[model samples]
Target chain A: MSGIVATIIAKYNYWIYICLMMIGLYAMITKRNLIKKIVGMNIFQTAIILFYVSIGAKRGGTIPIIEHAHGGQSHAVEAVHYINPLPHVLMLTAIVVAVATLGVALALAIRIYNRYRTLEEDEILSRIRGS
Target chain B: MKKLGLLLVILSGALLLYATVDFPLWGDPSSPASLHVSPRYIEKTMEETSVPNIVTAVLADYRGFDTMFETTVIFGAGVVCFLLLRVLGGEEGDHYYRHLPTGVTIHVKGAKGKSLSGEFERIDMLWTPYDLVIKTACRIMIPFIQIYALYVIAHGHHSPGGGFQGGVILGASVILLAISQNLRTALRRIGEKTVGILCAIGVFIYAGTGALCLALGRNFLDYAALASVLGTDPVTARSHGILIVETGVGIAVMATMIWIYNNVSSAGRYDEGL
Candidate 1:
């Protein structure tokens, strides 16, 4: 029981991320409104981004910015003193892609609304069946 | 259906939570992610690119190709929104125009190719009276927001912010303008043609720099090849190259965000919108 508690305490961030992702996924699957699904999708992306960024964190490390990188430093820079930058860099791209994806999805949603005059999935589906 | 969704969500969440046992402890410097190329990037970024922000160096210099494609992706999104939403030169229904002098609204039916004089301003079918406070506040804030965004982009080397965040802020100022006034007022400031061209131009600047490097007998996106052109040593050249690429990214992202907002808010009809 102590071991399990220790493990949970050590890795709680991942647990929270998983919970958030599940919430987002549940909303995406069950929400009838297109806008709600879009919001859910954004939540899912946010969870993943948070996960990646958390993976880059270090206990005693500062941000990825090098001190006196203009090169008048007396002390040599060590990797352990700074947080991992790779995930931050990758997540930056991911964020921009997320924004682009959201834009495209919202545009498509607008087009669908224009066609059916409704944003509810079942309503549009029934209208299609009637037509 | 909702029950099934909940069940599936719980199942996956539990599975993922179980998998967390294999992950490195939170904020562990010895994690596999930190053990690999991240160390090299952190150690060598200063020497190679002379940039304080290792993330910016890795993004613009080390991963230039990826960043280039990211810019292209944003531009493509803008183009896709345009193609999906923009409706051009169609027969719209009745036109509503408000005479400025008398505050009288005139409804013209089937007014195709009809031009109203300066005194009569076009209004949307669903028009709201302009609010003085919102308009004035936004107008005063817009220039400051724009200057801050420019600072974010230009001062990225020593700081946390860079092209993406700054570009979003810049694009948002225009969106704020659109919200405060109307779509037409915002569109008049930066025309549709200018936005479209600027979108392409930004991407072109990014790709053109890579092509320039290629022309100078180096591999694509190798900023060291820009040494002769930039009149700097290879290391400093890399730094300058990152800035140039960042500038391209800023422009592209700014244009794309504006383009997407313009399309979505107006639903492709270049008229009054919230």
Candidate 2:
């Protein structure tokens, strides 16, 4: 049991991401307000980004920017000395796409609000049924 | 229904947590992700591209196609939002204007007398008194913020920023202006047509760079082909190409962000909104 606890503690980043993902999922699933759902979606994206970035982290490693790189460095750059750049690069695109998604979602919400005059899913549904 | 959702969330959470047992521990250098193509990128980045920042080199050089499409995605989102929300033509609601000298507001019903002469400024229906402190503070800060944004884009090769981050900062500065003043004030500085055109232009710049490489009889986005045009060696040309692409990205991203904000804040009316 102690060994299992230690193992879980060592991989706590993944656990935290899982918790965050669950929270986002709960909000997305249960929230009636459209804006809340969008918030939940954002949280979900954040959790995924955090997960990828955490995977890229290396113990005692520096950022991927090479120091003294411009002045013709003498020493060779070791891969282990730097954190993973691929995930960061991928996540940069993900972050931009996430913002674009958020914008589109909000624009959609605005359109829905313009038409329905309310943002609640249930209210909109009932109104649709009544109409 | 809520209980069902809670149950589903708990089940998924447990499943994900159990799956985490197989994942490498946090910050493990030997993790699978670190062991893959990332190491080669980190080691060879400076040599191949002459860029100090591995992230920028990898993003703009190795994965240039992806970034181009990413810019396209941003542009598409902006276009979609514009289509969904933009309401062109005259606004039908009551128009509000403030007399500058007397500090008194005049409400004009209908679209008959829309234009206002000097000393009478148009305002939003939901307009509160414009805060002098906020306006003055942002006015002082806007120029500096814009300059910093330019720095972020230009210095991306050696630092933690690139076009996307810089572009967003530039867009945010404009957003700051809008929030500080009214939408129309911000719109006057950057008209709607200009923002839309800029959005397309940014993407065009990115795609155009790639096409330029292709025109030089090289593979798409192969910055090595740009050596002749830039009058630099192949390696340095790659670096310069990345900068060009980054600039394109910055412009597109900056314009898209502003475009989205303009449409969303005004709900396509281009008038009074927060």
Off by over 4 Å in 2: A1-6, B112-114
Cα lDDT tens digits for candidate 1, A13-92: 89889888988999999999998999999899989998999899997999999886655654677999999999999888
At residue B261, give the lDDT of candidate 2.
93
What's the C-alpha lDDT at position B14 in model 2?
90
Cα TM-score per model:
0.97, 0.96
Model 1: share of true interface contacts reproduced? 0.89
Query: How good is the docking of model 2, as DockQ?
Result: 0.87
lDDT of 2 by residue, A1-131 (tens): 99988776668888888889889989999999999999999899999999999999998799999988857545899999999999898888898888889999999999999989999999999999999
Instruction: List the lowest-lDDT window of 10 residues for candidate 1 chain B.
Output: B160-169
- Cα deviation at B141, candidate 1, in Å, is 1.0
Chain A (alone) TM-scores for all candidate structures? 0.91, 0.92
